[model samples]
Target chain A: MSAPAALQVTRADVCCVAAAEAWRGDGEIFASPMGVIPTIGARLARATFEPDLLLSDGEATFVTGTWAVGTPPVGAAEAGIAYRTVFDIAWAGKRHVMMGPVQIDRYGNANISAIGDFFRPTRQLLGVRGAPGNTVNHPTSYWLPRHTRRSFVAAVDVVCGVGYDRAAAAGPSARRFLELRRVVTNLAVLDFATPDHRMRLASVHPGVTVEEVVENTGFELVVEGEVPETPVPVEEKLRLIRVLDPHGARFREVPA
Target chain B: MQVADKRMTAEQVVAELRSGMTIGIGGWGSRRKPMALVRAILRSDLRDLTVVSYGGPDVGLLCAAGKLKRLVYGFVSLDSIPLEPHFQAARQAGTLEVSEWDEGMLQWGLYAAGLRLPFLPTRAGLGSDVMRVNPDLRTVASPYPDGEEVLAVPALHLDAALVHLNRADAAGNAQFLGPDLYFDDLYCMAAERAYVSCERIVSTEELASAGLPTQRVPRWMVHGVVKAPNGAHFTSCAPDYERDEGFQREYVAAAKDPDLWAAFVADYLGGDEEYYQKAVARRPVEVAE
Candidate 1:
């Protein structure tokens, strides 16, 4: 018989690992991840390092065990929190939601709402759903499967999620629990860790260059020195990812 | 003493609603919406309405029909289809006024209305463009030593509220057998008048025994109960049915072109609710080749 093949890591796997790292230190908080890869990442995080992280089945239940992406939660209903309770938990600053925005700026300002004027937008998207409250109340992060100049803009059309500069300007109340943790993209991972609170190039994914990231981004990113490659998932983590996404829905999101 | 029955037809409920009324609609996104009542309103001569909703096809239908003057909402999305096409078209054309609040802020506004409070202080919209977009919103400083300032989100007082549920009794005690209540009770409590349409009208004893007691929308808040089977069509009512994704796809497709939209309206929305239901039943099921 032929020997077992070596575990091959894909771009989607790297993105999942990077996305999971957003909730590395967040403990016992509700992890509301939107989209496929983010959901997979949140599940992986809960399955391994962050065991205390509460995960919802995207409808209205808190799921316990790990299940594959797109499958129904088998036994999560009995101990589920209703929609009203979800609002309460979010308001109490006990949740970290990773969202997918249409446009995001260097300052961490995101817009899932309309594009163009407030009154009459050229393209109307989902009106600021919970982005405003989520950013101002608790920790928030973002995941972009496709990192292009269009998404990583100089300025967002509408500020649904508050950035560091705007939070600072709003004073003590807005800054009370506001934390924009991380932004993971297909090309690289970014964070607002700079002194000026601008978006910094945290790390580039394997085979992706810092210059390539810069070229893709519309604004000037805070690239200090040599950017390290995003760490590949360990064997166990890769297995967990596979287990969490058996049908490979993550591949559909980030492609091969 | 006998208990009064608050049962009413969809048309009767729509007849009570006046033009330019601020109405709050229950259900989140595309799930469990009161589409039957919405269609009734569509059939009526109602115009210049200010609607408050989590928004799904109800908002899109109203926008397409030119019934809304203003819309106060957190978001309007079809869950699967991210941006609602008709809402997009209306906004792009500058046809309606909008007060876009944070989802939590909208909840707070409704809660404040239910409590009969002028406004409630919340940290949401403190630093975002929500303040800029909604210039009427004000910030209040804390009375204590910290002197912290927060946004005092004004109450979204509704003249009327419309919601859908899984079951209800004649006296208007509603129950949602679905996973989430989705703030439908809050929508009822926040309004001056509220109407609930359900998939089935069960007895009070059956309603009480069928679901958890906590899931019931008490009769005291609801003014009218309507028996509307498959009421939340296109949107999901769960247990009863899931979102009609095929129909919704047709809806989204129709919204793209004027000719297709006209054809859709002729085919689907030409007559009463019964006609619409019949048309929906007669649709050819898509079979993958």
Candidate 2:
């Protein structure tokens, strides 16, 4: 008989784990993920350790349970979320969001608006959805399915989400709840814990080297010591992840 | 007992639209957009329209028709499909003047207009490139000496607002059965005139029997109600029907080429609402492999 292979953990799995780690201390905060991997990560966090993580039904309700991706909400919603309630939660500084930006800079300034000059752009992206409010009101993280030099840029074309530098410029009020925490990418987990608030290499995903991350990133990342491989998802978490994303769209985003 | 007859034909609604007017089109992304009226405006040869919308294909179609002089929007997206390609081409080519706001700011602007307020104080664009890019935007100091300044999001006063809903009474009381009201009512109250196109029109008694939330635009706020079934069409009017993904895909794909786009506009938007419905009914929904 052939030996059973080790748990076939994929890059997406590591990325999800990294993303879930970003929400570790967030207590009873609204968890909003703007993309597929981030959604999986948010769902994974909710189902497992972060039981208090409030998840949206993708329709305007707060739903509990391991709801699968690519499926209409099957379970009963816990509560309704109107536009006013969303603002209430945001203004209370009780939310954490994982957003995907078209371009991100060293200081964590990201852009989801125009690509070229602000007046006349080469490409147009989804205009800033809620980046400003999310960044100014509460904690925020980033998810990058594909980590490349082009995406991790030296400077963003336009700042949609306020970064450390921009927030500081806005004065102390804008910096109150503003925390650019972790950035979970396909290759590695990054954080802005540096003194200068530059992107730092937190942990490289398994099978990826620090040099590879440096080579791919457009700007320098703070590399202090020997980087560790991001922790593999446990069997329970893996099982839950499978149940949460039955269609396997997460794998498609950050393939095995 | 006398009740107002607010019913209107799509063409009648279009007749009210003028060149250089600021209009608001309701619905989030492609959901429940008043596409029938948009088609009417497209056919009317109206130009120099400054549209305010939580945009979708309405923005794309208007841009494709060269009807838009300026766009005041949060974002123009087709949800499942990110950017509306026609809007993309127009903005990129510098053919359209755009004033983009954060989604919340756009909604706030509508709310302020609805309340008849001069401007609303918001933290939405306080410290970002939103200010740097839009130099016309100004800040308002807090009334309290201790309070910090905020961006004074101007009132989005529309000459007319077009919105679509699942159901409405003949007197113009509209109800949205969908999860989100999506600033539609605010758009209605914000405009000088409000036109609602609905999937069906029922009696006020039927509206009450349906037990829709009290969150509805009263008859006093609405000017015209048009019964344009399948009005939202490609845009999803929840509980009525899901978005026609196949048609939406085709529209998005067609927007890339001038020839294909022309053919698409001709095929679907060639005639009035009845012809468009017939075309829609005849075309089979493509089953995903």
Candidate 3:
């Protein structure tokens, strides 16, 4: 038998696949290109970054950091309209949010804020800042970047925003919404089983082991009998990003 | 019984308009605003109107369709949908005078105005340029002369409050069933007269049985309540009903192409109010699955 060629893959390569697929190559900034979400903000320009909705499944709380609120980070500056319009260019609504806490429940519910009570209690986190509305409103999705059981639990401590179950329950008006569009990670592609609430196995990222995904999940998800591997970013997505942020604001790991 | 076709007619409602009036609109970032009524106001030749919106297509259409002079908003929002080009062009051309505040601040401002309070103190305008734009809204000099942040957004008083609801009783009691407990209440309370459009008009008894009557608008404050079906189409979906997905997709796609957008407006808005229905009649429903 011919010896298997030496494996060629790294975390960086895997990360890009995780993100690019979530965006489905539609994050067109200028309607230009790259179309990558803000998470992989480094893969884009560094001007003004307004992440869609923080998508962490690991942590349900917020950390006090310069990037959380205050001034814009380094990379987000470029997305602003060239000249003047209304507010500054920092978060002109282009976004790829981060969510902490690794395990996400079947309903796409997350727990990042606190483990117990919110006020003067056990764990305190980024107090529900725009989570409820953000998830319901814009192009919202979640990300573990790194997945784990601690992140995905039976249910979140609190359902800060509408997830798949709630979105469907809300009405047809909100049907095309929070419906957990995508959940990206270091391993695979996850989608819902039906128009209902079951989180189903969509596909695996190239080189990720089925065991890795199983180990990371908190609740029981509908596993696929045969899962295909996710594809990497095509030349079109890369070329598109280059045009949207010619200044290279999003691609680099800079502060914005 | 619920009022069947209980309306003063389009001309009748339009005739009630006066100069230098304030209007309350029901919508959020364009999802549920009354674009048709707004266009009607534009065609009426009304001017110097102070328009209030929680943020919706109403703001842009009013400004772009060439009707508004001044605007009060918390944020004229947009989602996957882009900012209305008419509003963008107007803002660029400096024809529309726009004012903004935080969503909560805007609601409370209207609330205070409704409650007849001069203003309400809030923490929303902090750390944002809204304080600078509407400096008159911010405050200074606490009791101890130490620095304490406070702002008093002006109380909004409107000549008319126009809202679209899911259900209403002919007696003018309207009910809102969305999570957006926005300034609709405050707007209606602050206005001198109120007009409501609803997807369905149910009998007072049915409304009472539904247990939503408590939230209904009393006849005393309501000037007119019209049973306008599909009223929120292309703008916002009726809760629990179908969404205007095709229109939304078409709007975003058209907005991507200005030439296409211009042609779209010419074909649709150029026609009568029913123009939208006929244009969308042949359009296939997206997100149908």
Candidate 4:
């Protein structure tokens, strides 16, 4: 793609661009991203390429414009989203969530539940908030600030979100609406477009080597010849991201 | 004739709790939890209780008091503060069993119980570790052969539900001046009894005038009401008050040491709601980071 004149981009900026790319072509959908990085990405997507993406004020109402980080919307919202209405949107599959889990496997089975056994977890993390319904009902992508052997485990200790294998075993009804899309990490952008539904290394971020990604991942990854570097965000998108997140909290998640 | 006043002290309402009974506490995280009722439970000798909640300081206080034998919850977080330290210590020590569910599934269970259904079929726990941790949780096959299997979240019937609202009448009608009701009404209906603690006791007419939109819980659903000022302290009650961040930091920091935690709990846990409030007022507020 041709550059939009005058753009300076960092690796972390590239990662946000990749995260925003996950929701590309998604016209008019609830783009709910959990953590700081994904929140910036969702806002970035709404402000630029995916103007149709809907955002909430992180409280009770929806906002047409991207909100500055650490601040609620100052103007009127597009509409109100109550506790009951949020569930209605999710059950209808009108939502696309970018979740962050503690562990993820080759098949995209993620875990945010606990580290040890189910009965007695040594290190307990957040329980499955909405991962199960989000995965089965609509398209779900993952964003990990740090990617390592521990996070990209051979197998998750607990399966908080159903993977392709588990979804298939659960039957065709389970697989129909299931779309396990991009897995955006600090190191690389991976997806399950392979024949076996394994996570394929889509692109290595700038200055990151394919060898380093392979060394850090616990399970085998699908790496085809000549892995491409993730595309850099144009000047317009970069400027928009800075506005959406004036506090630079996104940098804390994936520092350049 | 004046409506029978259901007003009682927190100690009196908490006395209704028996050993080995299941209870549900309302609020999400550290927001609007019935800390006064929780403190009352701590003061009592209640033991082996099964507590179901979204969880906040209430769970931590109960856990620290050794009152819970089991905790059925989606998560146990303190909002601005991450995990509740006392809950973590209790879990690590294997003192109590836990049935972890998705946040939606827990809500569905309560909804089903409130509606008097055997179970609610939901997609929330279908592929999560919630089922694995809660092995007794079952799934039912869809009637249609092509239909996907859905997890059946059983009804979470409770002996009592303890909640704190911004205002209430002597007759038990409650109003939440906050932005969100946090499913306090569903919890109230899902229980055999619901005891509410409010920041102030207004007349029935005044509660009605607060407007229908703000009336979260109706009179019929509430069995008892306690006038506990600063009832949901240290937790945000919205329009009424914001979270006591400095005190929360102190609570979290104190839990690290047994002697310190014991001393902290002793200072904050006993006495009625007013006594607790005055005690809090006396402490020096730390500067926010």
Candidate 5:
């Protein structure tokens, strides 16, 4: 098929492409994206380059083809893998979930559980739902529509998802399957690919400067020689994203 | 010989539960919980109990009522509302002892208990703060040449297990017609005494005809079955009814203030299950924004 005409790419579109890149090499595994933009990205990935990746209907069954975010799956009955089987797949390290963290540190330690002291938290978020298991079991990425100092903290309040330092310290079992893949935020795509596994600014989104990303981050990011702009989705990808998210939910998540 | 009938009322089931007992509640976040049984616990004088769950309103209600002395959970969240208000308040207030595990670790713990094992080795909690906060958790070194060490998630043995399903028989054979069973069977197997509350009590033949045989929780694993239609109210009992999001919003709003909470308790939770159901039916439906 001929590629569709190139259109004006929004930040949300760039974010979707960036998020989908997280699962580019994740062959045959479950692409469990938590929110709208990520969900669109996962669907886009499956529709395009990563066709083998499994996508759950966000409830019980594995689904193919895309539906609008927040709508029910049309034909989930055919691929009915129950919650039990999902757990089994997760434990066996065959899933890559993109979670949203309330706070993330330089080492990639994330917190979704609480804000302050564990004994008496100032604010309690969703208690480490599957962060601990997800991080240690398989490739775990994160998506943040809004990136700020509060989210990019120097040290997280509670380490729900294990980072490089903690994984190294925890020994081989922790390190074996641990893969903190990417942190796709509104501003940039970041990863812990440094020599010491410190979060490095991989690419600044179009119109967003490296200074802006560094300024918003709570801790020092390993900014290398030259940072590239996050790639815009091509005609085909943008068309697929529109098809997957017909209601413009990704735009609602990240805004135009 | 006649088949033994293992039917009981919510109150009767609660009567079987002693104070300070560890109870495992089935269902993930706000879905298909044994909320009728949970409401029964609320009406009773049960206090200082240790509650285990992939919690939702069950944890919130228990926390609001000062029922939990300790809580072992993966997370306490109302799916629509990210954080459960009462659970958050209780945690911030330091009102209850909390043992938070990774969601998978919680499952493994229950699975180990179901298998009557002391602990199950897993890599889930290894590098995360779950180990830091819950210092009592131990690690087991692999006996093989690799000697890989993994967190030994201890068995979450319960005094009782409570689960809500779509249908069941009087002899306590339960079946979930929903797409996901959400570890209900494992919860039942892990507990000493297990009670099931279902939306309908069908005949054995009807129960067998309802869903896949794998979905059925055999009578041997269940100690009692309580038939309470809409038993998992406020939570989604898919193929039955969706989560009462409007009611849940009111519940969350009430949790923010003591006066509102008291009024909510009196208006909704004050009565018996029948009254509660009627109160729910009588309330004006809320239009989603």
Candidate 6:
């Protein structure tokens, strides 16, 4: 494939919100290598206004721990809690994390374990890395670099983690779960504000339309008003994702 | 009945620990955490005490001495250091009930229990047969009217969750500086009583002079506060302090070797915490080649 064009990026809140304006369902679903690597994470990070726990690490090398919200669902392996907290001490706070998954149902449920059941898992997975907590935490979200019927199936065979509805059932400590969220997809944005709490259409990506998003979705999604267009990555934001992950981990699925 | 602070001598903290009690600590790998408390816990008469953690030197040291009755963890690591033989033995023998939950579920459970909830249903168990094995976790009909099935994980409330901090005032407000926020906020809030150990007790004036007070821990939530300098030693550096790699390597080598581990433990863990300190004193300093 020919290399995509390059550009610059900055931390602008408007762009972050604009980027997620196409998000669906409480912002719990996440796709990777991100519709464009770091595009989703950076936008979400900025959208969340960089929660206290999400602050860059002390040496500015890591973030996620006592000071950071829940274990980051995104890229947190090298990340460390910037707080003066001991290992066990950090486990005691509010953490907002994001994980990339394969399937996302209307209920905001996710599947990153196996493509199918264990005996004949269509696709093997990265093991039970931490999808469980990514969903169970008070406020957890998911990302799917690809937005399609297969990726957003009616039912994920293996529910490795959670989304909006499951988090809601966890009760009181879960107050922070559903609040403050969105789901950014390659095609459009999804939300979980309705009574059923299923994935609902908010807006579509730039140059993409409602018809295109509907064609890709497997389950019936509740569509609000005439969806507006999602924000296109300003040249600069596009550049950062490309720079950090030159391979385009963000653009999960190319134009088929 | 009185909980002590990090400023309290190790002996004072040891006095509160009793046999068969469940102890919760903070840490992961051999990274950031307060090892001084672990040392104190090791010396206490606490036996068959159930332990909980995300894995690290804290769990490693406990396992090395056959002091753990049960372990609640998502994952435990002393980095290259393999887990202690006793934990492995207990796990192999089914003597120890290791309730493996997602790191988030562990936090949610603790937080749930602290809030007096019955359980926390998480997406973590969907594919895994956790519900099948741990029957306690059951699926209640999803009231969503959409017929979405879900699991109900019983709340997990520890008797106590001890944590170590970097900076704190005499009032017990603490501060953390790291990448992974292990599980301090939830655990501290959820544990019936929270114990905090800090490296320094900033003066009221110093705290008052602080710019970001939101980052500072509040005194209200803390039950007991300790001020111990270099407390993160042998565990992890508090932000600035680097990991004690040399000590970790030696411990890993020693832990995997039963004879070596036994010898080291006999001299260190086998005896009192003070004897353990003496053992520390006896170690030969590494000479640069």
Best model per lDDT: 1
Q: Rank candidates, lDDT, best first.
A: 1, 5, 2, 4, 6, 3
Clashing residue pairs, backbone N/CA/C < 3 A, model 5: none
Candidate 2: tens digits of C-alpha lDDT, residues A1-256? 9976556677787787888888887879899888888888888887788989998977689987778888877766999887657766876788898999988988888899889987788998888777887788888999988899999999899898988888888776566667898998999999998998888999999899999999999998899989888999987887777787777899888876
Give stretches of model 4 more than 4 Å off: A1-8, B144-146
| C-alpha positional error of residue A67 in candidate 5 after TM-score superposition, expressed in Å | 2.1
Q: Which one wins by TM-score: 3 or 6?
A: 6
TM-score of each: 0.97, 0.96, 0.53, 0.95, 0.97, 0.56
Per candidate, native contacts kept equal 0.93, 0.63, 0.00, 0.49, 0.93, 0.19
Residue B125 of model 2 has an lDDT of 73
Model 2: clashing residue pairs?
A: none
Best TM-score goes to which candidate? 1
Report the Cα lDDT for candidate 3: 0.55
Candidate 4 chain A lDDT trough over 10 residues, lowest sum: A3-12
TM-score of model 2's chain A: 0.95
User: What residue pairs clash in candidate 1, if any at all?
Assistant: none
lDDT, candidate 1, A1-256, per-residue tens: 9997868999999999999999998999999999899999998998889999998878888878888888887555435778778778888999999999989998899999989987889889899988988898899999988899999998899999999988989999998888999999999999999888899999999999999999999999999888999999999999999888888899888988
Task: Write down the worst ten-residue block by lDDT for model 1 chain A.
Answer: A72-81
Q: Candidate 2 chain B: worst 10 consecutive residues by lDDT?
A: B209-218
Candidate 6 chain B: minimum summed lDDT over ten consecutive residues — where? B80-89
Winner of 3 and 5 under TM-score? 5
Best by DockQ: 1
Q: Tell me the tens digit of each residue's lDDT in model 5 across A150-175.
A: 99998999999899999999998999
lDDT scores for all predictions?
Answer: 0.92, 0.87, 0.55, 0.86, 0.90, 0.58
Between prediction 1 and prediction 4, the one with superior DockQ is 1
Question: Once superposed on the true structure, which residue ranges of model 1 sit more than 4 Å away at CA?
Answer: A75-78, B211-215
Locate the minimum summed-lDDT window of 10 residues in model 5 chain A: A73-82
